[model samples]
Target: MKIVELKNISKRFGTILANDDITLSIEQNKIHCIIGENGAGKSTLMKILFGIYKQDQGEIYIRGERVNFRNSHDAINLKIGMLHQHFMLIEDFTILENVILGAELSKGYKLDFEKSRVTITELIRKYDLDLNPDELVYKLSISEKQKVELLKLLYRNSEILILDEPTAVLTPIELKGFFKILNNFKAEGKTIILITHKLNEVKEISDKVSVLRKGKLVYETDKEKIDISELSRLIIGDIEDIPVRNKIDNGQALFKDYITVKNLSLIENGIIKLNNLNFALKKHSVFGICGVEGNGQNELIEVLIGLNKKFKGEIYPEKLVPAIVPDDRTKKGMIGEMSISENYFLREKNLRFAFKNILKNIELKFIKRFDISVPYSGCKVKYLSGGNQQKAIVAREIMLNHNILIFSHPTRGVDLRARDIIHNEIISERNKGKAIILISSDLDELLSLSDELAIIYKGTFLKVFLFSELKEKLESDRTSLLENIGELMMGVVK
Candidate 1:
């Protein structure tokens, strides 16, 4: 049965027509994935369904009944729930309190605390969420927070669930476990609507897939009809071929010692974040680190950038200033209010020569080279699409021309076209004898770009493999190597 249906739904944000007559149907008890590039109207449509936005045209139907929701409360009352990209919870509250905040049960005007607690505990056990309801929200990790959100949906008895970027924070091992839980949800007759960018995940878990381009439904494919390569083409319309940068051998290149960290140890809140970490970078070499989120990647970056001053370590080039692009683009990379050109100027100190110029002389050059699509460089960075914001950052960082560079999740959340451009630029920089430290959760990207691959588990480097050895083993038996990596990540091979 069609559990949910949208007929000619349209939404406009000022001059931008976010959703133009989008018609879609989501069946019951199936994983329906909606795939699109950044700013391709995926979020807008989902927002409309979740009652966060009112459509200008068309109607929503649930089980053949036409309905209109004035706000998220109305949708929630109707047993529909949405898990946002960033979690919505009060840090001061416990998990149980956060889940039952708005949806509280009362007996004769008094809150039924014991009943709710017992129910929450039962639900946690039933769903296998492994969450302690008494735990403070602030103390939980990303994956734990995700489970709390899921628990909220289950507590509400929401039959239809909408998850936005659900797997973005998951490790490879955790991702498999997440999917297993989702599959269990399906077995229990709940419908799932996932909004995501990862094509490999779409192919792996989705029972049906829909492609949205320029705010219109371009294609819909069932499990039997789905094809990842064809879906990739749909996402990146009219784009040139995206070559996977797997060429590790760029001929014998002269190397110079740039940055080295010896016995790096950071103690935070009495927890050892980095356990005697040691690494060295040489010119033209790309050192890629792969690990689960919250396993000290952010701390390591901060230590290297001198944000965390107190650490037991010896850093060669102690006063090193390298080109650094942080993982969280909005939080650490750019200010939303600033124009694209102005952001560039903030990074490139040498571009501050022009106070009257909206764009730096060097910023304009790389903007065109990186293919940042915006009406003007003077436009606010926030107004530009996610891909363009990323492009702007990449262009600015590259223009700085620092010998040592650090990139964390450089291609994350960008479209395939932007991803291809960023990869090419990184390779070009490496070819020019620049040392790069790449930290990413993407295994394919790490394998493709890394001169040396390191697998980090629990704040310790489990194993480091040279590019040649890895490449040979990978080429000889790709499946075995991938399985080996997965085991290593989960501590199964430790």
Candidate 2:
């Protein structure tokens, strides 16, 4: 039976028709997956359903009855809950406090703390969730925070749940655990609406799939009838392969020993996050670090970029300037409220060229070179699309007069066109004799760009492989290589 249905839904925002004549139905107790590229109107439709945005025209039916939601509160009361891509939990509060914040039980004008705590503890044990009720939200890991959000919805007795990009930050093991929880929810007669751009995930867990393209419902099918290649075509409108860069040899090692990091160790929350990690980057060489997410990738990046100062490490070439494009752009990379031109100035250096400051001309040249796609240089970075914003950041970082570059998940959340531009930029920098450290969760990206690869797990370096030998080595020892790397990432072996 269809638990939710939308007919002739239309929404407009100024010059953009965010959603045009879209219609869809979601079955009860089934996983409905929505797949689309960025700016494809997927978020708008989901926002309307969650009552965060009102549809300019359309009719919505919930369980065979027509209904309209004025706000998120109304939707929640009607048993609908949404877990956003960015979690919304207070960092200072404990897990139980965050879960029962807005909806608290009271008795005779007094807060019933004991009753709520008992109920929350019972729910945690019932669901087999490994979480401490008294643990502060700030102390929990990303996966743990996600589980807290889920518990919030369950605590409210929500019948229908909407998860947006739920597994983007989870490790492979955590992902498996999450899928098990989702299956349990379905078995208990709860409906799920999953919004994602990952095609492999859709094929794995979805029962029904819907594809949205350019603000319209382009196609819909059951899981049995869809494949990854077909979904890619529908979403991107083409199946062109990305261009691979030709390998080039660096002559005479222009600064062979550019930067060296020795005995790097970082401690956070009374735990050793990075322990005696050591590596060297050669001039004009790409050093790739590939591992499961959250296995010290973030901490390593933080220490390198000077964000985490509480670390013991001998950083050679400390006086040499470096540019970095961080993984979480929204949090660390760009100033959202600043204009494109203003942001470009963040990395500008004063050059004594004929006693004149020529930073303005340099900024203009970069703006044009990167094809930032903004109306004008004065446009705020926050108003630009995700891809354009990313381009602006890349332009700013690469244009800086630096000898070393650090890129962390440089192509994440970027579309195909933007990704190509980024790859080309990386190659251009490499050819210019700049040492680079590339850290990413995408193994495909690591293999394509790295001259040498290293696997880091639990704040320790497991092994390093040279690209020249990878092909021959993999042919002879595929099982051992994959198993050792996998086991190290999971902390099964050192």
Candidate 3:
């Protein structure tokens, strides 16, 4: 039986038709996966279902009964829960307190802490979450915080769980465990709605799959009939090959070192954040750095970008212009309140007179070139979807036209099509004799683009693999190569 149904749904945002007469259904006790490109209206349709947005035209039914939702509370009352890409939790509160915050157990006009703790502890044990309820939320890891979000929904007796890119923050090692947790939910007869960009994950966990493209439901299939290539084609309406790193003649001989660091080290609060790092970034090359996040990636980027000058290092050419696309777009890359045109020329040294027109023209050019879907050049960037926001930041940074480009997790929350576009642009820049630093948690991205790959762990480079060497190993022993990289990332190998 269908647990929830949406029929003839349509939504619009000003001039953009976010959802165009779409209809979809969710069956009971099955893991349903939704796939789509950025701004393809997948989120919009889901938001309408979750009561965050009311459709301009449509009818919703839950278990054969018609319903109208005025806000998220209405959806919650119907036992529906959504986990967004960014986590929602109060850092200062304990896990138990955060979980039972809005819906606390009451006894005789007083909160019943003991009863809530017992119930929460039982839930944790049943789900194998392995989280201590009394632990403070501020000290939790990324995965732990996500588990807390899940606990919140479970505590409220949510039967239909909607997760948006929940696995994006997890490492390859953590992903397997997280998927197992999802399987646990499914085994317990819960209906799960997963919105993700990774096709491999969809193939692995979904019982049924649906595709949305340009605000329309274009395709649907069962797990037994799913084809990844066909799904990709449907999402983007065209098939494109994975990006291949361009080959340079005579390797490092044809390129000059744009920046070199020797004996680079950083110590903070008596903890060594970076240790004796020595590397030279050469023009026309991509030096890839891959590690489990929080293991010196931030420290290394900070030192290189001159954000932290307290580090011990020898940097050549003391003055350098570096174009950086930071991992956190909201916090570091762009101002949420500013218009696209304003953020585009945010770093300009001179915008005294007639600069508005110049900025507007620049924004228009990039909007056309990058295919950014914004209502207008003056739209606040925060209003754009995650992928479009990323595109805007990338466009602005690339238009800076600097010789040194630093892209940190550039394609974190974007779709496959956007990923391809960004990857191609990175390669194009490298071919133009621009030195690039590619820092990412995605091993596939690193392997696809890097001329040389470094595995950093515990504030040190455990190993650096040359492209030629990795390619030979990949051609001969692909499994062993991945195993080696995985072990290196976890600090299991010296």
Candidate 4:
């Protein structure tokens, strides 16, 4: 039976029509994966179903009964729950406390802790979430925190669960475990609605797949008919081929070193955030760093940029300045309310020389060259989609003409088209003799781009792999190569 049905749903934000008469049906007890590029209206459609947005023209039927939701509370009352990309958990509270915050059971006006504990513990074990109910939220890893979020929905008896980009932060090993948990949910007869752009994931776990493009439903298929190449073609519509990274033979000897670190360490609140690490950045090469988050990547970036001078280390360059594209583009990279041109020239030292016209000209140049989609000139960066917003930041930094560049998760939330564009640009810059520092949680990205790849665990580098060596091994046995890398990231293989 169809558990949810949306008919002729349409949503508009000013001149932009976010959803154009989108009609979709989600069956019961199946994983329905919605695949689309950034700003393709996948999230919008789900939000409408979750009561976070009101569709301008649509009729929603839940379990064959037409219903109207004014807010998220209404959806929750109907046993529907949404898990956003950014988790909503109280850091100071324990897992059990966070789960039962709003919906606490009562026994004669007293909160029933023992009853809730028993139920939560059983749920964790049944689903294999492996989360401790008594553990503090701040003490949990990203994967564990996600389990807590799942526990919240299951505790509410949610039959229909909607997850948005849930696997973006998971490591390879953690991702396998997460997929297994999803299968368990399916076996328990619960429906799952997953919104993501990862084609491989859609192929792996989805029973039904839907494609949206330019705010319209383009294709729908069952598992028997799913095709990854066709899905990619539908999402981005014939973009140019992605630029390839040429093999670098003896890169360390051929290129000049731009920056070097020796005995780098950082201690915060009596806990070591960065261990003794030594590395060098060379022109015409990309040094890729991969690790689970909170494993000293942020600390390393801060120290390299002179943000934290408390670290015990010796940087070769006395005054090193590099253009950086931060991981969290909304917070660290750009101001939302500011115009694109204004954010582009934010770091300029000479106000007199950085005229408005000159800045606008540079912005226009890169926008055209990079194929950034903008509605109009002088538009605020916030109005652009995630992919366009990322392209803007990347173009701005590259236009600065710096010898060294630092990119932190440059393609974190972008579409395949934008990811390809950014990868090409990075390769183009390396070919121009510019040193690049690439930090990403994605193993495929690191393997494809890095001249020298390092795995950091607990604030220290476990091992560094050369491009030629990894390429040869990957060509021989792909599975073994990934297994070795996954073990290194988790510190399982010392």
Candidate 5:
């Protein structure tokens, strides 16, 4: 059955036509994927369906009946639920409380917690979801929180579930588990709509795929007809292979030991965040930490940047000037209310003159170099798009002449064009002999950028793989190094 259908949907934001007469149909009980570059209107179209945005022109049909959703509640009542990329759970709430929120069970005048707990337990068992009802949201890991979100939809009796980048934070082993859960959903005749940029995942889980480019549905095909390369080409047009730069021949060492961490162990909320971690960074090379999010990646970055001092670690180069781009940029990387120039100044302490005056000329030069699309240096960071905000951060961080750069998910939430620009910028920094620690969940990125990749799992570096040895292992072992790395990331021993 065709559960949802959109006909000639068009939406415009000022001069930008976000969606241009796009048409799509989603079937019942199938994993339908929507793939696109960032800002390609995937989010906009989903928003229109969820009643977050009003379409200028188009008709949406649910179950062959034309309907207009005024708000998310209407869509929810129609058995539709959406899981955004960013979690929407209250940190203070318990797992059961977060799941049953807004749709609480009430008896006469009071809320019925007992009844809800019993019902939630039954649902969790039925879905094979493992979660402690009394556990606080703040205590759960990223993957656990994601499972909670899934349970939220199931609790609502949502027949059609829309997940945006569901596996972006998951490790390889966790992803396998996730796929198993998805298969269970499919078996139970539940419809799923997945929006993601990971091409291999689309191939693994989706039955049908749709490609959106510049807000239009440009390609639709079955999984059997599509491959990763083809999908990549469709989304970003033709692109050449990413060439690995030759090792620089500069014998002059900018710094013998750029950064070092010893015996670093962070204990947060009674959890061993990172355990006895030790690493040394050298200039002119990128040290890539390949792991699933929540596997001490955040803690490692925090300890290095002097943000979280609640750790048993000796951090050398403690006072060395460093620029860091956090994984969750909206939360830790950039200040929304501040202007781009202010962010620039924050990154480079000397951007302001001794008189405490902003140097407009110097800021503009950095912005242009980083290709930040801002109307003016004084424009508020929040006003810029996600890609532009990232660009601004990169611009500021690189221009500061910081000896070490810590980039977490550098190209996250960025469009293809902007992602390319960011990649080039990372390359430029490497060429300049700046020591970098690149932490990312994107496997392809890790393979492409890192000379050495280490998988961090449950507060420890489980395994390290040299990129040069990956091909030989793949040929001899008859298994994927990436998959093995993913398994290690999820604490699965192979």
Candidate 6:
């Protein structure tokens, strides 16, 4: 059954046509994906469907019945729910309160808490979501917070769920578990509309894929026709091969360690966060760390960046100048209220003389080099979308030319085209003799860029191999390395 359908949807902002006569269909109980480069009308079209944005011209149908939505509440009342890329829960509220804030049960105008609590508890247990109803949202992990969002949708009894970048914050293992939940939803005949940049997930889970390019529907196909290369080409029209790191000139050249950790460990809340971690990276290569989240990746990055000093063992070059693209860019990477130029010139001592001129120079240089589309350089960063904000941050950090770059989930929430651009820049940095430590759950990305690969499990390095040593073996059988590395992450050393 065609559960949802859009006919000739068109939207405009100022003189910009965000969506140009777009049309698509989403089937009943199927995982339908909408993919595109940034500003390719995916979000705009979804917003129109959710009633966040009204299309200037279009017809929407639900269950073969024509309908119009004036606001999100109308869509919500129609059993539609949306999960945004950035979580939308208030940190100060408890899980139950957050879930049932607007849709509260009442007896004689007084608040009815007991009934809602029981209902939410049942939903949590049914979904195998290990979360406490009494717990505040502030203290929960990224994965747990995401579960709360899911619970909210269930609380409202939404059958058509729209998810935006749903797995951006999840670990490799958490992602697998989440997909199982989605599968269960499918089995139960619930429809899912997923918006994601991860093409592999689209291939693995989506029943159908609809790709958009520059506000137009460029391609549409079912999973049976899914191809990674074809999907990439459809998303961006073209793409380059995965980057292979270049080995240094001298065969016997001493690759000095820019950052070295020996027997590093951290105990938090009577739990060993990291257990005797050890790794070394040369000055001119990318060292990729592949691990399930919460296995001490954050602590290790903290140690390297000097954010957390209470740990056992040594991180040499104690005073480190590291440029980091953090996982939670909004929280840790850059200040949102600050202007792009302000973010660029922040903490610079040399710009005191002719500060305005220097700031303009920096802003113009970054905009030209990184393809940052901004109304004006003086605009605050918060107003930009997730992808644009990320690009601006990447531009600032990379342009700084720091010798050591710590890219934590470098291309987490960006589009396919943006992912390619960032990958190219990371390779460019490596070629310039700047060492990089890439921590990501994306295996293909790691394989594409790493000179050395490290598989981390349970706060320990289960295996680490230089790409050169495994080159011949990987060439003989490509799937062998993926299988071995995947098993290692699962705590099985096959």
What would the TM-scores of all predictions be?
0.90, 0.86, 0.92, 0.91, 0.86, 0.87
Candidate 3: where are CA atoms >4 Å away?
105-115, 134-138, 238-245, 317-320, 350-356
Tell me the deviation in Å of residue 351 in model 3: 4.4
User: lDDT by residue for model 2 over 1-494, one digit each (tens)?
Assistant: 99989898998865567789999999999999987766677767888888999999999898888989899888887788899766789999999899988866421335566887888898787776789999999878778899999999888888999998777666566777888888888887999999876678889999999998767999999989978888888887874665656657664244467778999999888887887988888888889887776668888877776777889978886655678887767778889898765676665755335211344465467666764555344566775655567777878888884778988878765555556667878877887788888987666566667777888877777777765565555668766766665666666765
Per model, state how many residue pairs clash.
0, 0, 0, 0, 0, 0
Clashing pairs in 2: none
True lDDT of residue 51, candidate 1: 95
- Of the candidates numbered 1 and 3, which has the greater TM-score value? 3
lDDT of each: 0.82, 0.78, 0.86, 0.85, 0.79, 0.82
In Å, residue 241's CA in model 5 sits off its true spot by 7.0
Q: What's model 1's TM-score? A: 0.90
The regions of model 4 sitting more than 4 angstroms off are 102-115, 239-250, 350-367, 374-379, 471-479
Q: Output the better candidate (1/5) by lDDT.
A: 1
Compose the digit string of candidate 6's lDDT tens values, residues 1-494: 99999999999765567789999999999999998877677777888888898899989998898989989888888888888868889999999999998766421335577988999999888777888999999768778899999999989888999998888787677888899888877887899999888888999999999998878999999989999888888877754554544544422136777778789888878888788988777777888999876677888888788888889998787888788888788888788898777887774445556467676787788777666656465667875657778888888888777899989888877776667778888988987788899998888788877888888887788998775655655678769888888889878975
**Residue 199 in candidate 3, Cα distance off native in Å:** 1.2
Write one digit per residue (lDDT tens) for candidate 5, span 1-494.
99999999999876668889999999999999998876577878887888788899999999899989898888888888888867899999999999888776421335678988998998878778788999999878878899999999998888989988787677566788889888888999999999877788899999999999877999999978878878888987775644444546444244466778788898988988898887778777778898767778888877777778788978887875578887776677778898766776666655445222345665577666655555445667775655567777777777777878988888776655566667777877877888888998877677666655778888888876654565456457634776677677767887
* CA RMSD of each candidate after superposition: 3.0, 4.1, 2.7, 3.0, 4.0, 3.4
lDDT of 4 by residue, 21-135 (tens): 9889999999999988887887778889999999999999999999999998788888899987567899999999999887664213467889989999999999999988999
Q: How many Å off is the CA of 73 in candidate 6?
A: 2.1
Global CA lDDT of candidate 2, please? 0.78
Answer with 2 or 3, whichever has the higher lDDT.
3
TM-score ranking of the models:
3, 4, 1, 6, 2, 5
